[model samples]
Target: MVTERDKELIGALQKGLPLVRRPYAALGERVGMGEQEVLRRLADLRAKGVIRRHGVIVRHHELGYRANAMSVWAIPDERIDDLGEQLAGEPGVTLCYRRRTAPPAWPYNLYCMIHGQDREAVLARRRELAEKYGLDQWAHRVLFSGRRFKQRGAWYRPPQPAPEKAEVRHG
Candidate 1:
């Protein structure tokens, strides 16, 4: 069960920890906990599978990856997991996952994001991925991003209190 302290930690994390050498320690100070306590709690949460990872999320464009595309493929449903893992292992792939497809219309299920310095390189990498992964047989599309907005970690909100039911007046 989540305790009040966990809620406080989550609430503070929503705003993002300060950018410093010791981010967890800084986060602990913001949440009124010792650095060791913070690390201990985070480790506990990880052991329980509450949080998947603890790391930095960089803005690719700011880091020189000026062009990117969300490459999608319509692979056989049974082979999706296998192919998704393969795509995730590729060098240029930044994000990879499977999505539900709307049949008779939208067909792609496996999706991944590829980043590069320019459009040409991005497209070239997509072509190489198709050839390397034997994805030529499947229908796929590479959608180069026209614009980027809202690139940040998730903003976690505090859970709202459940509303109390009112007693009915017999009169």
Candidate 2:
């Protein structure tokens, strides 16, 4: 069960951690908590499944990686784990995972993202990975991103206090 303090902590976290040497301490100050206490509470929340995951949302374009391609492949179910592990460990592959096939329309299951300074570089990297992993043997496609979408963390709002009732007297 989440308490009022937990709600406050979640609300503060939704805004993203402050860019500081001691980010947790900053958060602790905001919620009237000690840094160590805040850390322990966050761990408890995670253990109770209140917090599922914590990750970074990178803006590749600002970092000079303007080109992005999502290379998808339809690999044998049994081999996906092995191939995915190999490709994910390679350099230039920023994201890699498996998704359920959409069937007749989309059969691709395994996917990996490659980001580079230009389209040529991204394509070359994809080709190198494909050839090195024998990924070309399977049906695959490289879809270049034409645009980017806003990325941010999840939001959690605090509970609002109830309004006080006005007193009434018979006139």
Candidate 3:
């Protein structure tokens, strides 16, 4: 079970670790913990599913990517996995994942985000992708983004967890 200190550590991590050689040590210093303790706590948090994913998140717009497009496809159920992987490998394809298809309403199961400096360049890449994958025969759409807001990575650190009942055992 998570405690107050665990929550504090998780909350601190939402801002990201320091860009230093001894990042854990820096975190530990801030949290009144030893370096090893911070590492152990982070590992424990991951094991307990408190933290789902750990990685560096880049803000593409800040990095000079002026335009972005979400190219969604109505991929066949059997072909989604292979095609999704192939799309992920393409240059400028920043994000790729599958979603549950809402039949008759929305059939787009495979999705990818392509980023570039120019909208036309992004569209050209999309066309190349479609041609390379023969996506014209399949249903696909490249919706160029006009504006972006709140594109930061998720901050999973909650201030306080909701109350829950846990069974107690006495030895």
Which window of 10 residues has the lowest lDDT sum in candidate 3?
162-171
Question: How far in Å is the alpha carbon of 95 misplaced in model 2?
Answer: 0.8
Model 3, span 1-171: residue lDDT tens: 887787777666655788899999998887788998888888997899766557666666788898988888997888889988898899989889897888777788788888898899899998999889887687877888766563444344355543222211111
Model 2 TM-score, 2 decimals:
0.78
- Clash pairs for candidate 1: none
lDDT of 2 at 26: 99
Best by lDDT: 2
Q: Clash totals for all models, in order?
A: 0, 0, 0
Instruction: Give the least accurate 10-residue stretch of model 2, judged by summed lDDT.
Output: 162-171
Per-model lDDT? 0.78, 0.81, 0.77
Considering lDDT, where higher is better, how would the candidates rank from best to worst? 2, 1, 3
Summarize candidate 1's per-residue lDDT along 58-153 as a digit string, tens digits: 766889999989888899988889878888888998888788899868899888889999999999998998888788699988888886674444
Q: What is the lDDT of residue 91 in candidate 2?
A: 96
Show pairs that collide, candidate 3: none
